[model samples]
Target: MKEKHTWLDAVWRILLYFWALTIVFPLCWVLYESLKTNPEFYQDIWALPKQLNWQNYADAWTDYGFGKSLLNTLYYVGGTLIVSLFFTTINAYALTRMEFKGRNLIWGLIMLSLFLPGVNALVPQYVVMRELGLTNSIPGLILLSGLGESVFYLMLLGGFMRSLPKELEESAIMDGASLFQKFWRVIVPLSTPGIVTVAVFKFLGYYNNFMGPFIYLSDPEKYPIAVQMYSANKQMEYTADWVTLFAGVAISMVPSIIIYMLFQRLLMEGATMGAVKG
Candidate 1:
């Protein structure tokens, strides 16, 4: 039987629609603005463009140095994802699945750290990076991000790992599989959904990270898209090329949009599974 819609349900639906419009309207506005000329944009910020100026995209790509920044972002995001995911998976597996001394103590420490403010570590992190001579380089940024494991991801994956059937590892052990073999062959494949969820969240965080790059890097050429876009904003004060800047902003949004579109289903599935398991 179809459930009857109540007044509360109608109110929730209206609020959800309003929230969706709040997000979608700005994106649609920015996209069209990127395709307009400066005169058209200046004449009416809210009006639709009469003609799409494709040249704005070209100008943003070439003149504004977004092309190089795009490549740098890809490299940084990819490397950090690979390194961080590897460590996070291993750490989660060991903490959740394996029997080891001091494991509970270590986990408790990690959980406790979650309550601590991350900003407290910034000065010490910078000093360590400076001492290692790793500041202002792409590898330095990658190392910093990769080594600093996210407590949330660790817990998320750990919870998922705990939900896995113990029999799988038991069978592997009976078959004379080593500890590494059990983890690799039995656990890793089953935990893929959880891993992908963590990856998506991490990708967004690392891709859009501005503070690390801005504080650690001084060279313009080494800047990622976030910093490069920020620099572009500063330059916009003099150039006054608002449309090209809008184009650049649109370009920066593309990768994140694509990632979400492609993996939206898996993300939902993963989150649902994690919630159920927790």
Candidate 2:
């Protein structure tokens, strides 16, 4: 019986290692090719570069307009994150702790919407964005992205908040704390893990959001890196400079990777928050 358990563990470990390699290898290949010129790329797709051509990075940054795209992405994502924090936290607090009419019904509707396909709403979303005069505008794009409570974020906080004892709020009340004080002081501080977890997830999503910027933003100057990369991809087809194209792709990947590495711990805590009760 012990031997059976040991063998199963070994098998699982092997599978996990293989999965990790599948992800890591593609990134390594892209980085490798980014250093080579067009001739070198076709000559040996898998070989290392003869010399590191750092100029490819410069061309990707300047010639392709990636510098401008990077700034625009920061503005759009920053606005979305700021607006979302208030809405997600407040909505979770009210639905879980405050007794209000139609609370369950509201939550039920959110849960139901989660199962529906987002692609189905593209036509309606486009029409609404146009009617609001938001198309091709950064502020308009931010507003469209920040609308509605994020179902996953709300659910994560709700589970973690539910596990928290009501006595915390009661104690705050005894000290003459108002409803707003109890929430911002007690609840937000304690629920940091879940908040960070959801934040990392949302950050990655918004950073790599291509479809939103592509459809709504008609102007090339306003495109995020994701959309800009698509345009770069097309240019490479004509220029045949796959090296610089890969460089642009590499630049686009760096931010998300750095952020995930920094806050990965919060994900584990958030995932397990529902199971343990106070």
Candidate 3:
């Protein structure tokens, strides 16, 4: 039994190592490629740089207009976070905690949206934006992104809210707390984990958004990092300045990776807490 267990443990360790490598290797390769000159990259695409070229990042930053793109991405992400979180939390609270006619029917419709592909709504959404004269505006982009209350986030939060003791709200009411106060003081504080998860997901979606900006924003100055990166790649000459392209890609991804690492623990807890309790 001891011998069998030892063999199984060894196999598991090897598999874990392979899994780790599978994830890390691509990131490492990109980092390496970003430091190589165009000639060096073409000469041996897989070879490590003879001398790490730090100037690649500087060139990419200025030439790709990453500075402006970065600012635009921040605005979009921040707007999405504020708008989506507010609506998602309020809607989730109402759906889960308050008694209302047709509440379940509304939830059922929202769940049905989960089955519908986002692409199906593109033409109508575009027409509405055009009719409103908002096709090229940042506010329009933000509104479009925030229009759909994310059912997945709502459901996750609802499950978490359902797991809470009903007496908590009842006690608040007994103390003469208004419905607003009860939700603000008691429910919101307890639902932090779910809120954090929703915020993180929204942040990522807005930050890396390509299709929305691509379709709606025609002004080069207003383009976000993802669209800007594509523009940079498209303008590359026959020689293909890979170093700058890779650097641009790396810079674009840095904010996402940093945000994920910073709030990963909270996200994990929020995602799993409801499941564990349920």
Query: What ranges in model 1 sit over 4 Å off?
Result: none
TM-score of each: 0.97, 0.94, 0.93
lDDT of 1 by residue, 167-234 (tens): 99999999999999998998999998898899999999999999998999999888899999999999
Candidate achieving the largest lDDT:
1
lDDT of 3 at 97: 94
What is the C-alpha local distance difference test score of each model?
0.93, 0.87, 0.88
For model 3, how does the per-residue alpha-carbon lDDT over 99-215 read when each residue is reduced to its tens digit? Answer: 999998999899899999988988999999999999988888988887667788888888888888999999999999999998899999999998888888888878878999999
| Model 3 / residue 166 / CA error / Å | 1.0
Alpha carbon lDDT at 171, candidate 2: 99
Clashes of each: 0, 0, 0
What candidate 2 gets wrong by more than 4 Å, as runs, is 1-5, 274-278
Best by TM-score: 1
* Candidate 3: 10-residue stretch with minimal lDDT: 1-10
TM value for model 2: 0.94
Q: Is candidate 2 or candidate 3 better by lDDT?
A: 3
- Model 2: per-residue Cα lDDT over 95-209, one tens digit each: 9989989988998999999888888988999999899898999998888887746788888788888888899999999999999999999999998888887787778889989
- Model 2: how large is the Cα RMSD against the reference? 2.1
